[model samples]
Target: MSLNSVLPTRPIQRLSEALANQIAAGEVVERPVSVVKELLENALDSGATEILIAVEEGGEKSIQVTDNGKGIAADQMLLAVSRHATSKITCYQELSAVASLGFRGEALASISSVSRFELISRQDVSANAWRIKSDSGERWSALEPVAGKLGTRVKVDDLFFNTPARKKFLRAPRTEFNHIDELVRRAMLSRMEVAIQLVHNHKTVRQVEAAVTREAQIKRLGRLLGDDFVTQSMHVEFEAQDVKLEGWLALPTFNRSQNDMQYIFVNGRIVRDRLLFHALKQAYADVLYNGRHPAYVLFLSLPFEKVDVNVHPAKYEVRFADSRFVYDFIRRSVRDVVARPITQADAMRESPASVFERPDQHRQGKSVSTSFLAPHKPSPRESQAFFAFQQPVELPLSDVPSINEPLLQAYADGSDTRLASTSNAIPPLGFAKMQLHGVYILAENEQGLVLVDMHAAHERIVYERMKTQWQNQRLIAQPLLVPISLTLDLADMRAWETHQAWLEKLGFELEALGPQQLKVSAVPTLLAKADIAQLIKDVLADWRQHQDSERIESQINARLSTMACHGAVRAHRQLSLAEMNQLLRDMEQTPASSQCNHGRPTWVGLSMKQLDSLFMRGQ
Candidate 1:
């Protein structure tokens, strides 16, 4: 045969059976949370009114899910455990609009292959229930007849036992538990009408009863979120075309250290889409710090065809037809909801304490002295009166005192010193002339006109000062007359343990109450009327999110800065001419005054040339 006579042969396509199954398993079951998610979806798809999940050691050793839904048939038991087999979809067109939680039907097969699985199901009309066990699939067996309810129950043990590598990749029990908890939270939010209960290590971690109405669902969420959140959150609802977005948004002032609190769902499927996340960031742009995330439970409903939910293996991500429209809709909805005034009556009604309360207040009484400066103390009357009101106080910018004339004059003079001193030291080319427009100042440099963003600038200044104290390890601590005990999650306790010395160095006198709790006898003096519990929660949450030590510190610093900035005086309030000059002078002296902490310019300058150009004098 001639060398060129033979035609090119197509490459053979073959992957090892074990490897192929493992790959499939990886796609359907990424982690314990993935397995939980699939199981929950199956229950929901079957029209389950009540579902119970029991896990041992974060679902590492075992996981059992029981649901009061239509059970599987004896003949369908084998098919249920077969790959690519699903009852949720019948025809090819059904794939276009997938309303059910799961359609691939690979979850059961994937899960069973890696773990010892047992499934028992009984239909309402069937006299005999069916049971199947899959151990390596090669060896399958059926359970003897037994009394069973008209539903399905699945038990998975030794997850990833056949795949040691996968099991090795599993995080610590506590970390895994957090993931599982997050999954449950998302599912509960999506299907509020279904009663869901989660048990770990024989302890009930979460229990949500079926909600008859949307308002009841909101109430249940409030109970789960905590009293402070429920009291501070505002209701949000908006609809555009096929999309409807609804949820509760926490006030800008009521923010979390991390983005854990932001829960978003797409067409009843819990997902983590960056578009929605970015929209949230835009909605609370000026209100929150860069690293801090707002607390929200936004639910998005739209036609199935309008969204593609097959983006992620866990189905926690989606692609929208018009992402910008969705983003704008969410941003506007949140902004409008937050802008409206919240009433005390509404807050009280949503308060978690009103729904559930333990007979005994878990308050502790112990005192410890520290060498650091003491925490700021408020009057007993002030402390009592603060919590008495449920509504947040909305103060006008005018309420703040104007800058004194003498101070302004001094600042103006100081500005000259700054310009003269740094003229040679720092390049003038980088400095842009800024023009004050009402309360806003705009500056243009080589990069861009820096918008001084008055509030942000003031906040950065205060934050820098506070951070200096913290960095120098010279924080003042105030001892409490009575110690306060805090019950926290295991992860939080571990975080505290890891940073115990650092926290003490920062003027916090803490003691471990037990494995999952701590007692605080003192706090940093810089914080006025601080809620120790909330502060600890924020710190732990931040620590968990940013595992990098350096990044965590940076996030903490940013948070501190945001707090200082919000508390600082804003512009446009009637400031004395002198005060304005002083603020200007201060701006000239401060390093990086061109922009605020949020990367927005702190001031904008309108040069004489630009002003003349506007008047047709450029020629």
Candidate 2:
């Protein structure tokens, strides 16, 4: 407890340049993926058009990145590997509007300190390439001329070899490689104009050609994201307040079990910002199933001054000067596009035109564009179907027992070829052919075939309708027989006070029992079955964690999802053809109907080519 001893234990001394770099390396060079990301950014910033990445044993043994970028001169080669050396920016003023991806200039220095590193570069105007080498936080060797292309090639060997502690944290080769692959994928997405190639253990893994056109971009996305994602995705382009967003978002039906596929880039820099992710989640809240994540590759561009990218050491996180505005912009953009009904163009993209339309249509003056589904207003009855189902009635047989004959007759009167030719007139879901095992609904549409989960689809439709109605009606408060009292921390109390009115709107009747306590008298009727105390605690936590947002909506939605599940039409219950058609029409009109409240795909489209491949067509 001696103050003098504790204060005098160490003298004020400057750290060695090597030690300083090693410390920086501890932050910047986290793993193979981190190194790859930094190098990729540097290559891109250097005006690289083509980048080739080679990894041996998941970048542990060696990592080589060759890029056709503007290479450095011999005099600059040493500086490039030195700490805090950068050509990206100068002076404090430049930090506010940094446009380069690797502006911190700590990556090369940091990485070289922990690994055996080499840099070879030959400027377009230079006679030959100059090479520099480094090992174990040592100063780089003198630049030596060597034969090389008019670009730069970086080689990292024995990563973390000098730091046994850092090497201990490295994951398995396959696992680390997965991280590297994902980083490369994001880098590729951030710069579509750049061709990127990845080689692991001498085996070519991923190769993307330069994309300059929309078609080429789509092809590249398809190659990376798979044809299903490309087919199921919607193109989005929106601008507001000089901020532009452009990308492809998978439809609500096209989702993943994990959030691995979500990529968001801010001004060409890939990031994992909470604000961006929260906005995306909110946008897909109504459409995506619970616990399911949407897949999207989005790019947002704005003036560099509007965002702060220098807040984090690794530059993976960013702080927007107008975070609220940014969030609203992204949310609105996604919602605006996702809320729109699927049209003929969407169907065409999902399958071949020949499968959905007559070959003569291409020859004729008429076009398929006119055949797409126009926006139709939903009927009040259809919108209120969820409420109707809640009332007493026969489950499936009692409602429309004899409605199928006429509907079946109408479909039976038209031949498959005729139906296919006049696709413009047919509904997007086409006509229901039959139900399979009381679960799946087999239907034919412009796109080869669509299989719908009758129960899941109806569940979503009902859930959406219920939500719409509930929002319009507002929550009705149900009084509790006995009041419940709870204590709150100062932060939670402040949150409760700030969000008092919002809580009241959600049908929570609570009053302050003391400075840090309250008595709950009532709760929302819809959430009456929920654990009231736990729900309140969760709401308070949300309010404290995410100020200026309605977290209760998600909680309420969860409860409503459970209700919809129970109220939905059960499987094995036979449906009349009319009822099935009505459901299909309802689905077309309902927003986010492609997915259930819990995020499961309600329907899947099978293209003709897929079917043909399965049957070995023309083989």
Candidate 3:
């Protein structure tokens, strides 16, 4: 009885070949996007001069790809649908030095297993062409030889026809189309020599003719990204042993809410590598704020053996033999390029105002204004009052509960309490009455004028207060009467799961409504008017774009910057005198009040002597 109880009841058995293939298909050809990527790679590998893509209803009904490449022979038509059949590579030794974008040769087989697949081809020298159709091998046929040009055309219709479960997992038409469009864009960036065209529902969505040079390619990318990006971009180039990195990076001033603008390619293959992205962050660390992604089109070329492209079925990710070396190389190269001063031509290309105008001509008629009046002499008693006001006053820590604990401790311990004590000191008797340059206040004995950058000052005050409330877990949430439902991508859903606790801390209360949907009950107090659905999508999109990195802190910083910018005071709005005075008072109490969160100076002080010199009164 004991021996029988210890033994297993049944032996394990292997899954059926069909079931196992389907599982592999799920990994390799997950959706229409997977099919599009594979077909495009094959076209490029075939040395296609011009490739065209046509889709219907986001490829739910059909996907057709045509390429002007050396087509297959009549005999190879049937074998093309068979697994492990590819002309790109043959031996196991070639696996280490794979040169083509695709080599596994499993895409056509997997796709045919799930969809209605048809292949039509004719070689350049052959007069007759062949066509073959297969539907999960259940029904197969050969069409009559048809006359066609020297190229290949593949049409996949009714994808997932044999697997309703996989079909059910498909997203909406628009969403799926966006994914396909992104795949096409990535491929286009990797291959600048081949002309590419994209059509959806008989309308041309995107088309790129073979560019004359790398510069022309970058200009084409500018057109796709937007004219503003082209104008703001700086060209970058660097070369190392058997490696080269070249592209254009947007100026520090140009940024995006999400990092969608970043593109990286390795060995002529578009890839999403974490090390490359991290190196980009490191290069721009001192220049950009958190959450703001720089725009760039970076292409890296290296020996094929140095990179492993088979890490992911999609082939969009790669592992490098010397990742750190690649990272440092890219970082230093980008930094060097950015640090170089922009030439006159570069400036003109980057800024519209610089175009068609000479700097000297623009400044010709502008004469410096030079007018200053002598400072009004004050009475002895007024001078004494000003002096007395400058004396530091002791502030009781208990009196200001708003003060952070670390700051209070610093003050109580009598360590560098000058700024703190001066902050608490009473304002001079005539402080409110003093005005210089119609904006700044000339304090009695302070070394500098209490100058303020109207927008930046307010931004700091608002940001600090909001950040404090956000950090203390005391967000005042506003519940929604009717909760909103959000549909997201798988990557975003994964991000939500990983950061659910952090989201809750930031005053977001969400629950899973479906496979890729979330139900939101409330939002952060500071973001009451924010579109919760859009915000969730944006956060998720950002998470997906930068999720490959090891540094979650970078993502957190980006979120914080987003929140700060959303809540900060915008420029050009006029403030009343009282509001301006209140802002100054608050700035006096804030640490690091001299700069904004992004490290740009918040205020610039001008002394009386400097102002007199500018007015020609110093003579």
Candidate 4:
């Protein structure tokens, strides 16, 4: 076949400007939220400190955004709606370093192409605002003088009216509004100093005041996420290698079934990164149960030149200059908060009284005990508040704080009697009163009754202890008396070839007998009794596709968790009050002690107010 025969006779023609814009709209304007995202980004880029968003019929009918930002100049009115025109950046150097959330310049053009669009603005220097109108972005009206405030207002109506096919795909009003609501949430969180209000059909849907202080910020978070999330989350601020991460991480006990509550902002721009998300997953791997996702609102800030934000049309994905370093930084930073030993100060912060705190009194208001301000050494009183008065340790449990037996004696209702005396401060876990059915530990704290699952708590304690004991040592490889053989395909063979050293480091010894067959001579001592063949197959199967250390560690932990289960104290086994209290003390000090390895809650609290409510005491 001749090359000329394969070619088309006619040359391809350039697309019309209107068609080009509509095509761009296909990417930039997925739904009502897409338009809201673009407009809000523009408003923020304009240095707006206050913004108002109004929508009609889930934005299918109309969307109007007004911002108190430095308005556009009268001369730039036409170019503002034109394709590939933006004042945020002027050259390739600026493109490489996109400080503003919207730099692609396609958003306004793509948006105007598919809707009735109007732009009104009056700069600080202008005596009056100028207005420009566009219908499907093809023709624009000449700028006309109009009375307006010293800011900008962008109104979009009849979205996708020029393209019925796109309009036909629009979702239900409430559904589309929900998407818009979520998009606004990111915008609100992106700028806490900016006042934001959203109205739907003339009724205010949401509003947030400008948050200028730590207290106001926590209240804003509570209003957005919920009082429970606010109360149960902790503040995290970590910086290394010129990258700073500050945000809130919910306790493992306060996890979600889906990632609905996860929000990550990069330099005030909301983005989704698989590598960052995977790092988070690794951080919460051992803490969360299968199928459960952790909820967090993290903000990562680095130099403007270190990240590329122009990779996606919608600007949702970003590429970091050093993805690996970023990954490790996120993983280590979150893990330090997620998996550290709980201190007495931590328990005091989550005190029973904190349970009754108003929604506005969120958890993040409390500072972390660190050198972020100054190194704080807990006084003897701080650590000893858990006890009324120490009794010499006569019990068999090591490192267990023995308290006067009478100090543990509580009222029949499981409320502390000594705390009422005001002579001794109550501990976080309080004192163990008795064992219930050898399965639950009944305790009394200053808060109220606390019921703990003994087995689950003990299991977590032993697992964490084992992890610490083994943390510094290389995995000891156990040689098999008889080697197990397996047959593999080319992909699995390639995975073995690529990650053979990692496998060996994790305590696996494999030899390739042939291209299609492999023999395993040894495995980790921890997994000596595990189904070696199946484990290897499962790990290698995943290794062929996923090339992260998480997969290997997950497999190891699964085996280790099973081992810890066997080592933990058994359910339905009788124990003395001292033994029960010892377990409680261990739990208070253990990392992720609130949940077992399987993610089941190890303990639960019942505030006196809650208990009273059950009996209608107030009424």
Candidate 5:
């Protein structure tokens, strides 16, 4: 009975077919939801346009899936349930470019081994349908003639019945069903062209129609992500080289408390990739509010060889050949589109003005007004052009005229109607009305009202300008009057040697005194106040771990952000109307100005309809 006596010295032996299959089942069939996922993927791989799923007693009693896809022939019925038998690939080389959703071929065999499985199919070439059932002897029943459509239907009864141990681990019925519901939702989002129906306990639970057009697609997205998400979202399409990304991204104002609403797919297969997630996080880093996650349903398409989806047995993760390239592409593309100015047209797209316009105008043969303000403000051109009224012009910071002159001239020379008419051409942020409590600016655009946090907005503008200036101009190297010699370990010395030129470009005049000694004689002007010794040590450690210089750049940016924050305008400090207007205009022209350095939104919009709804205008 001693522990040492229990050690075995027996020879290795092959496992029995039944026992081996039962073990495989543990990997492919964890619960009712896992079974559903496998079967759904199989159906999709078969080119199914319509799929129906039925479950009873939370799939403890039975689970069935029927698909309108290419079915198997009578001759292939037995082999179809056999392990390692698949039509997806024939050689090892095919693994490099797997395009199908399900290719392992073990899903069917493993699932059948632990449950009472029934399969019925009829191929287009076959004149009669065929059916087969799994017997207790690890063999399939005869392929008897059966009546069925030109597709496949699989029914699994009493899951884990043969393996009572797995059955014991089953969760509560409601808990299991919730997981199945989430899987079905992911499937629906994966392919909008497919119609899906789900039934539970003899009652229809969910139904999604096939989406064929852009409008239909958005409608389907609305059903999955809610009407508010679709209404507040923007359609983005970006293509570069061999990659293409298309989807809907919610505006910065429409953020979520958690990442539950993010759904990203790679080449039509739903995946959870860290590289993609990081890129998305960085894209929204400067625009979204802190502790908030952006909601999106994005799809990225690239060459099959560029990504490897076979990294996981469940195929939920992917590895990119050039991860950094993919990351940068996604980050830059998302940042570009999300930073565009919101226009009156964008507002109308979200909530049309026709809903609020009186019906009497239509009967009277008068054009309905799209403007939110009463009597409607005319386009900026209609007003005597706010400033020269010719074309879009850029006002440089050094050349901007005094605020007093523009404010007095605009009000004295142009009437309110003229100013309102010119709102259309007065940039996206429109014109500032007045300062609010010395912290906020109230402005009027074609859409309605816009409120901006002055300090936060100015902070972002300054930070972006600093970043641009740094990128455009070489770092000024401030040479040390007395050379600072520091000692380094073997690893740090090697890193220094490998990245010396890169370090020099970052304004570090480093020289190797010996294998274990380094002399730092110069540093970047921006980082003159930083702890140069500690900064270099941190940079070297970061470079060794990730083999990239981005860590140093990020560190530099952090210090610059702090500098910009201190230099920005402070709250509770009054600003004249002219200064506020200039800040608004600058915010419009700056990239990623929606938020400040800390991921806090700098502004929010309120449309006329939203304001009207507060007072029950139509009612």
Candidate 6:
């Protein structure tokens, strides 16, 4: 055999500087959007108050970004386009904890390598700006003096021109523009204090001024996310120790089919982290319709050292030192906001007086903010009492009829004049006038007509009450009169054995009967009537599916919801006015009572003007 037969096919060799950069560019610059993201980050890090972007042919022909940021000095202008050179960090310690949006410095080098790049900048009020140009990855022209203001401008033409293979991967102009548009949207949401403008094909498409005020912030949110999102969302804020969360979450009923509208920012850097997304998804579980997603723009702030942002090349992912703690905080905070009960103020847009106040006060003075549970403050014990159904607690309303008493009888005396006299004593849900076809409860508040779905409202009330105690670790467990025996496989047996403590926390007691047998000796007291054997089997199934994440609590919630639905009062069940009013009162105190377990609204409030418009009374 000759020497060639014994040797390798090819010899090892070092890649050239230009070839190495283009290879690195494959990871950093995928398309026009990648270029946009890097340039925008640089502008933001430079303390740019405002930035302008221009694109032609979806950035394939040319792309330009101008920013009112402190420009780069002439001396460092050459180094700015060099790989591994950055002004943001000087040491490994700074690299470990990066605060600026762009720290690695590879963005400029990769971008300039594959395109005809031109950079112009003037620091402060300098007499002239310095310019640099590079047509290929290996060589760059010497810095030359140019006339310019105190800012920076970057231009790239013929992207992927030298690399025909990469150019072939480019999509249609409109499709590429969509990617650039989305990138700008993320930047806009990340820094509300910075003004941004986007122009494509010589037309201004997206532009937003600095959002310095709360109203302006909301306006920008509306402009970017749509007016419907702003109107349908609730303001949310939560802070604990080192973490703070602030954002707007859309109501459960206003969900979308895709997760596209969800935006999460960590320390002003936009990220699409799976952990953060999972926390939010779990928070909205069972509340939003199945296969639907909630719209939100949440900002998370914590110590920079606590989160590692160097995990991904695009910096779109992060590693939290205490991931579980962060997950729980985000989950609980979002859950609380999405589950806030409906108040009278929410039902009435412009009411002058509280309807639930005493009859005299209803006729005079400014309206007090009050919910249907007016005079009674909710107590944890009261919630426990609500589930037991052992005690008939009376609502503290001297002017209102008690549970056993009928509001119809209280308001009626067989004369129109007596009914007119009692109108001033209306409550927030008002006095239930009558049951409409045994399915609807028609009532009247001070502002307008109020309608309630007797069955749906009762279902939500029951589910919320049962969930509240369980969440607070106050779930009452009932020992079975006769323990149900079950046979299980090896996996099921081990699951139950391993998760005994967690099951107990959720108010379940399982015992081993044999190697493949299990005994269900207890269950949550509220779920006592549920099929014990099937419930455990379902729970075990869930335990297997989510064994990795172990969010078994949410799976249990789903089962409880089904039980609550079956146990609630059925539609078309005739009820006295007092029973309907009682449900209304419970609803105000129940979290997430605005929507049923199916994510459908449980009630509707029609203002006087809307009611009048239906009959052409005002028109």
Q: Candidate 6 residues 278-327, lDDT tens each?
A: 88987877666556677889999999888999999999999998887898
The TM-scores, one per candidate, come to 0.56, 0.84, 0.59, 0.84, 0.82, 0.80
| lDDT for model 4 | 0.78
Tell me the spans in candidate 1 whose CA falls farther than 4 Å from its real position.
Answer: 1-19, 142-144, 340-619
At residue 418, give the lDDT of candidate 1. 25
Cα error, residue 120 of model 5, in Å, equals 1.7
Query: Over the full model, what C-alpha lDDT does candidate 6 score relative to the true structure?
Result: 0.77
lDDT of each: 0.64, 0.78, 0.65, 0.78, 0.75, 0.77
Best candidate, lDDT-wise? 4
Which stretches of model 4 miss by more than 4 angstroms? 1-9, 345-396, 400-426, 469-474, 480-500, 511-520, 528-547, 608-619
Q: Model 1 over residues 1-619: C-alpha lDDT tens digits?
A: 9866797767888976455667789888777877788898999999999999999998988889999999998888888987789998888677767788898888888888888989899989889777889774445686555568889999998889988988999999889988999889778877889999999999999999988786787688876776566655656678888889887777554555567678888777878887788777766654443455567887889888778777777777888777767877887777655433222122122222211223122111111100000111222332332121122222111112223433323444545322223222322222223436546444322222233455655544444444544665546688988888999989888888888888787778999878877898987665536666777778777556532123234445556655655655555544443444434434443333333556333433333454566578858
Deviation (Å) of 242 in candidate 3: 1.7
Clash pairs of candidate 4? none
Cα displacement (angstroms), candidate 5, residue 413, comes to 7.6
What candidate 3 gets wrong by more than 4 Å, as runs, is: 1-20, 342-619
Candidate 1 backbone overlaps, count: 26
**Cα lDDT of model 3 by residue, 523-602, tens digit:** 76556666668767777765566433323333434455555555554455444433444444455555344345573435
TM-score of 4: 0.84
**TM-score preference between candidates 1 and 2, better one:** 2
State which candidate, 3 or 6, has the greater TM-score.
6
